[model samples]
Target: MPLSRQLVLSLFSIFLALFIGAVWISVSNTKNFIEQQLSSHAQDTATSLGMSITSYIGDKDMPLIETMVNAIFDRGYYSAIVLKDADGKVILERRNPVSLEQVPSWFINMFPLSPPVRVTELNDGWTIAGQLSVQSDPGIGYGQLWDNASDSFQLILLMFLVGLVLVWFLVRMITIPIMALVKQSEAISQQKFDRVELKPKTLELRIIVDAINLMSERLSDLFGRLTNQAERYRDFAYSDELTKVGNRRAFDLAFEQILSDAEHQTSSFLMFVRLSSLNQVNCNIGFLEGDAYIKTVSDLLSEHLNKQDIDFTLYRLNGGDFALIIEGIDEVTCLDLCQQLIDKCNAIEKSEYESGTAQIAAGSFNYGDRKKAILEQVDSALTQANFNPLKWQAVDKLQTVQSNDTWREKIKALLDKDTADFIAQPIKSFSGDEIYQEWFARFPEPDSKQHIPMAELIPATIRLDFSQKLDELLVRCAFTKLSSQSGTVGLNISRLSLLKPSFQHWFVTQLTQLGAQCSHLVLEIPERCLFSDTNNFLSFIVNVQNLGVKITIERFGAQIASVTHLRAIKPDYLKLDGRFTKNIHTEKDNQLFVHSLVDIAHGLNIKVIAVQVETAQEAQTLKDMQVDFVQGFFVGAPIALEC
Candidate 1:
């Protein structure tokens, strides 16, 4: 029961007890008073009548004696008045039956009062002439008693009502602060630091409020520190120490990830740039001047390449060597981009280089094959470029395996036919309880027997501007599956999907059509998507959440700075990127990074889920760090839909 109800019930019981006791005492006293008055009235009237009738009896006036008896009997006070001789024979008598009209039968039975009879001796000048008996009827007494009881009942009921109202008011006052505390407790459970501003007059409650406020402050401070630690840890692991570009480890991971995608196979290129005479420059110009020259070259390469208007990632490979990876470009465009870098490097002149300017070598290779083959080709091209100082060359160029028309036709057919099959991968809590299953749409690969991952297909879908259609299909398939399943299902929705008004309308209509089944749907978006156009993203999240669909952010650790934005629009789940999950148990930095991320997400009331968990040890470490959910091959492989 709620605190308010329990308090009200307790107060009401006390009021009832008091009211019952008061009424019982009042009724008992009223009954006794009415009984005493009736007895005293009968005795006093008989004594007075007997004394007055003595003169008449002494005179032997029978008519006067009868007149006195009749006079007293005419009054309604006495039920019967009789004047008799001493021999027990009646001389004169007057009698009336008792009549109680207003009194109730139950009341009379409960508090019965009978009039007393009194006998008096009438002396005739010194001798007893006759005996007189007088008794009062209980009708008037019962009537008066009933009236008193009725008045008392009305008065007691009035007091009871007034007392009950007062008790209710008091109970409400006591429970108001308690209700506020209850809400505060709920917020705390959700990892929110909501405070109780309601100040209760009760000393004990005031102390409790102070304690809760102190706890909230401490929790906020702790989470702030953890968030800072997470940002620093990511920077230490991925950032290059000198140039601030991604380090070699970061490059290796990103390269492997890109190569894993089957769709970008023939459209990506890797460029190798080497600065010659770096050792001679360091010996002559000192390490500081050499470092400055390297930084200048790195900045100029990035500036000119970005000016070319292409998608690329620049990384410093080693002391005097760097690499650039560009995607979705043809072979000729790739050669033109390498020439641009060579021209920019040749233009640089240093006044304090011992009269020698910087010499740069460049090479380009395809990114579709094995990492070793790609590196070997780029190195071979670089060897050729090193022969000619301050120039670039390409030893190998990636040939177009298939035309864009083929990709467009294939994707269009899938979108038109809506025959794309999806697989479900289960994500479970630390306790092994199934929370939901994440759905992945399968795409046909070049080899007929194999299928490409959703990650690989998404880039092509975005390139073709068919991401909206893809999202619609995914949502449709998810809803169809969820309509019959008893568990929840999560679907990944692209940022492009929300950009289209038609897709938004379709999403709303489908949710409405699904009705209650929509509750089982969870939509996940990349965290990088929220970094841009935050207002619309938040609005979109709110709109979907209002329809009972949950929202989660996948690949959450890409930009650690974005966590600050989570406070305003907290998502239901913050799925840590698989990069952080790689070798987490053995890598101290990865463990710390994940721990801090969890702390930050929890502070914002968002659940932390570790994806790509492939080992028992990794899952155990994640559980120890308080991650709420886990998803990967080790937990369960993706299963095709039965239907």
Candidate 2:
């Protein structure tokens, strides 16, 4: 049933059929010709004998007649010859014993030959003196027929086999191209679009091959384009625009994956970094220059961090901040990594100062309970670095009792009520047109007058290891508020919220519940948070993108080495850190830096937003730089807005 076997069998069958028919025809025709030749010889002999006898009779010579009859009988062509007197008595007869037995009885029966018997009357003058009879010996004819058929049959059998073999070989050659095409087609069906280069010169086969090649070429092109698009989308979802590091969303995702794996398979550690003096540098030299410094630092960190043996990831959490998640590692390994990062940061600071870039400060913390302890350690280290200007220190501060107790009380109260509050900030376009509102966290209080920024409250919850509960509440509150709104609304998530595995399921469920009403929701994350863990971050961003929600990287260009990160994780928008737009007109260097940043972001199809604009001149400068959106005191302060 295979193609090759079927082809061979069909061809051989035809060959055998034709061979048998040809052999039979050849044997039958040969036998008939031999029989005819023997009969003709017998007739000629009989005619000659009669003529001789007639002459003798006319001469009236009895002796001559007898002699002639004897001569005719002596001739061996006839099996029998008889001379009879007037009374019909036989005078002469001849037969050969060896000739009679030469032909087999079975052969004669199978192909019987009947040659006509001839007789001539010999008369003396006008009277008939005697009659001559002659019969041809069928033995010689039968013998020749049998011998020739046997020889011819053997030759025919040999030729038939040879011809069949030749035909089989020819068919195989003919089907080769077709078989190759079939294989290629099957491979294509499996999405393996590999091509065959062989060309069959036969007109029909050539056409088929060319068509297959054309189809393969088209499919390869289609798959290539699709792959490129998917990669671009992936980059946009996970990357920070300015610094190019994994954003907070990416980092949180990676962190959760690592933690889960570690809980099930291996040990892992989280290193949270809070860049000291980054805010000061942005506030002083401007955010554009600040971003350049951050990009440079990120490059340096990545160069040292990308060791083949180490399982580590780096992310840009927010302005002048980053995080690293090292999986299958211990506290000692975590400490060593932190030291290396610190050294890299110091080297970057020195290099920047020499190049007239802004000075930088850095702090790091290693966490076992990454979701809670990582941020707490980083925040504590940052506070220490800020308070003590002379030396960089890793402050090993535990969460305060008051912070822990407050988070407990707050979570219990929220759970009991099952209610939360939301705050909305307007993200205006460059022309002062309202593009959308970004939602931030708000806590419900018995007294309407009491209000606090979600930033402070969320960090407090993270330090208390209650961010998962807080995130669920925030998502519910944010969704409810946005469902009633007419424009886009952005929501912020903490690193702690993202590292929880259940967050993805919970977030997706919330979106499903909101249905079309959630279309306007945009999730905002700090750029620094993405590098906290690479794998989880990449996975998280990809998962979120599948949900059809818009995502943005906040406080973009906060890291010193942002370019490398941007190449890997392309975020949707680069929200220019506010420090850059604070005093744009007076700074020539800042304008150049902003222009360059804008160009880079645009090249990657990422939008740029300038935050904290205060003057028309500043807005005009940003507009010239082609900033997509602007937000600041000059545009409109963060005021209490209706949900």
Candidate 3:
């Protein structure tokens, strides 16, 4: 039972016991008083009536004696009155049976009242008259007793009702704060630090409330510190100190991740830009000016690329040197982006550099490209740009790929016909137990049986502006497939599509239509998403989660602000970036990093998933770090969706 009810019942039981005792005492006293009064009344009446009838008895005036006796009998106080002769023969008698109209039969039977009879010797002028007897009727006494007890019972009931109300109030006063404390404790257990605001007056309850509030405050403070600590950890390891962009180590980690994701096959470019005036500026001006210029360049890159709605990461490899890996765009678009960067930088550096702005070199690569090969191509182009009049060049373009015109038409036709196939890849626990599956979209080449790799297809779709339609198609197809599936399925939604208000509305409507089936679907987005358009992304997440759909953050360790953002986002799953999960068994830094990430995620009540688990050793290592799930070729390979 609820505590309030239990308290009320307990107090009411005590009151009930007291009430019963009171009624018993009242009834018992009334019964005794009524009996005593009856006996006393009978004695008084007998003595007086005998004295009055003595003269009549001596004269033998039977009519007069009868008249006097009848007068007393008519008073109705006595049940019977009799006059007997000296020989013990009855001369006169008056009798009446007891009548108790007001009292119930059960009450009367439970408390039997007997009429009291009294007799006195009568005398007639010194002669003994027959004894006169008078018996008192208890009916009047019983009626008085019943009325008193009934009034007492009613008065007790009123008090009892008033006491019950007091008890209810008392219970509420005690339980309300206790219940609030309990709710606060539950929220704390779920990693939500909400304080109990109500202060109770009861000493014990108030103490408890103060204790809980103190704990919550301390925990909230601790979480804030922990989030900051995580940010520090990420920045120290991956971020450039001066420019606040990815450091050389971060770029390598990201590049390694793309290289490791052999199944998805990503196609993108590696661009290198070297400042033409940084050396001169640092020699003529101070290092502070050079640092300021580098910072400006970093900011400009972020500002310009974020507007493109393309996935890219800019990095500060070293002083006067920067690198960027831009994805989800065609070669022509990437070249155009390069030209814009060159022009924009020159416009800012007319006074600093006679040779104009920085030299830009772009080299394209696909998944599985060697780190050395991509770097050498881009670095050689960078060296060549120093001599070229334009100070910009594109090297090793994807020669085998179709032109942008061909891709636009192909992607448009495929989206128009809904001609993409989907496959499912299982994410399983370390024990090889299946947890859930993720769906991937596969598109075939337009006029060939061979399908274009995802590396090429993703960029083409984005460049052609077909990402929104593709996202819609994939989500709808997954929702349809979920109807017959027993477990949930996941789909990756592009950031470009998610930013569109129209796509957001359509996605919400589609999720609502799923109803119960929404539980069977999960949406995954890159962790880098938080670094841009975060408000819109958060709003989208709220809508999706409100509809009972799950959200997973993929490429989770990509952003330094992930810990702080995760606190706000509260995704259902946090899939670690492939960079951290690769060779986890052999990398001590990776182990420590993954362990902390897992701890932080688990602390927030969010499960951690280690992605790109390509070996049993890595899976076991991740399990040791307490990753909740693992997914990759070793755990399960992608298979055609049955439906």
Candidate 4:
């Protein structure tokens, strides 16, 4: 119960008790006073009548005695008056009728009042003639007593009710500040430390309000400090000290987040960047000049990409290589962005610097599960660019490693039979702590005791339009097994599933069923597939996000143009392309580019993750770059552990 209600009830209870006691005392006193007055009047009337009727009674004049008695009875105060001679014979008798309605029978029965009577001895020349008796009507006294008691009771009840109402109002007013404090406390417990504005006149309430405000201010300051610390920690882990783009770790984390956002939204693109002849520049000109060249490219990309509504982020994956994850864009826009970036890279002029050449290769994919295929496509495009020595080139199609129909059929059969299983690979924090595990689907056949990667099966499922069913089964199995625990698990979605509304609906329904546990599931989509249809994909992602599931973009650096999409679809994490992390430390130019990329991503509060790290030195270098998390062979190889 509210404090006001309790206080009001208590006050009313006390008032009722006191009112009842006072009413009882008043009724008793009034009844006694009325009885005394009636008795006194009856005694005086009888004495006077006895004096007047003495002569008549002595003479045996019964009529005269009766007349005197009748006179007194006619006054209506007495119900009856009677007289008798000394010989005990009745001298005169008179009676008046009493109305039953004037005083109720039940009340009369409960409090029966005897008529007040008085007698006087009449002497005729010093001798007693007869006893003169007089009585007053008890009904009159009863009526007066009832009236007085009723009035008093009514007044007491009215006062008590009014007093109760006043108490209720007063208590509510007094406790308002306390109620506000309680609400504010609840908000603080939820991590929303907003101050209450209620000002209380009560000294105790004022003190409490002041204390609450002080505590809230202190907590807000603490949270600010924590956010700053987290940012600095990110800088240390993912940023390249030299060029300030994403270091390998920063690149990986940012790219992964961007890719995840794209896949979830189904509307983002990627840009894979590589510096040309960084080795030749360092060999001919000095390491310092080579660093300047990398810095030049980073500055150009950052300046052009940092615009309003452009979801673009630059990341230095490692050593002369940088990646940009753009969101909220299509293939044509991404292609244009790539061309612009390449044009800027080509325009750089060197003074007293070694003869160096810069080449740009670009590829765009509609977001899908074919991350490896997208990367290979871009690589093949870059290889084509390398052969031509062109200023700018674009890959016409994203390449896919064709798997045999037999493998596709086997995987489809496993999924249909509900025999598909998953292996989880942990994505670890820099401190070697496990944050979450990426879920990898597998099909184990009877003859082969070992599990076969679902990658071979997933591509065929996409072609067969059965990817959504496979995705649903995998999600159900994973959730059924792992929903009991609290941790993030990654699930890969096929490109074809992105176009199916049923697939989106199923994903959303499953997430809703998980409820609070939905946070444990991380849905990953390939960055290339996101560009297939940006609007529908974005809506689908937003709907699922409303259900509280985490979204991630996979293979984030395949297209240079998709960086524009990042602003619109802010992902939770970005996984950098493995190619950038490979040989990152030895490549100085790539290091500078990766550093710049990390800076861009961190500015937007995105985290970076480096993939495929193979050495302790490489991990340390990534750690120094301020990456949030790392996943590679050096850190921990992907394993087929169950979720």
Candidate maximizing TM-score: 3
Model 3 residue 284 CA deviation (Å) reads: 1.7
Q: Model 1, range 296-371, lDDT digits (tens) per residue? A: 8889987887565355668888987888777655555666667677777767855454433333333333335588
| lDDT tens digits, residue span 1-643, model 4 | 8788788878988998999888878877877788788789889998888888877775667677667677778878887787777887875777777755777677677555666678888888877777877777877888987788789989999998898888877887688887888888876654456888988887888888999999989976765455455445546765777777667665554444434332123344566677777877888878987888888888888888865235466787666777666654445455666667767776774544333345556665443436667667766666666566445466775334444465466656666667556665678887888777776666676357776534334434544556678777777777887766567887886656765787888878877777888777777776765665787878888887777777777666543214445544666777766555656778564465456556545654667777667778777777788877877666665666543
Top-scoring candidate (lDDT): 3
Model 3 RMSD in Å is 3.9
Look at candidate 2 and tell me the lDDT of residue 442.
Answer: 58
- 1-643, model 3: which lDDT tens digit per residue? 8988888889999999999889889989989988888888988988997888787784468999899889988998888998898778998888898887778999998888886678899876677868988888888888888888899999998999999998898888999999999899887766678888898989999999999999999988887677677677778888899988889988988888887686556668889988888888788888888888788878887888877767788999998899999866667777888888888787687587655658999988777779898899899989988898777888955343687787788777777666667788999887778878988888777778777677777877777677788788777766766788898888888887877889999999998888988877788887777776778878988999999888898887776445557767889998888988888899876677777777788888899888888888998888878899999999888998764
Lowest lDDT 10-residue stretch of candidate 1: 355-364
Candidate number with the higher lDDT (1 or 3):
3
On TM-score, the stronger of 2 and 4 is 4
Which 10 consecutive residues of model 3 have the lowest summed lDDT? 559-568
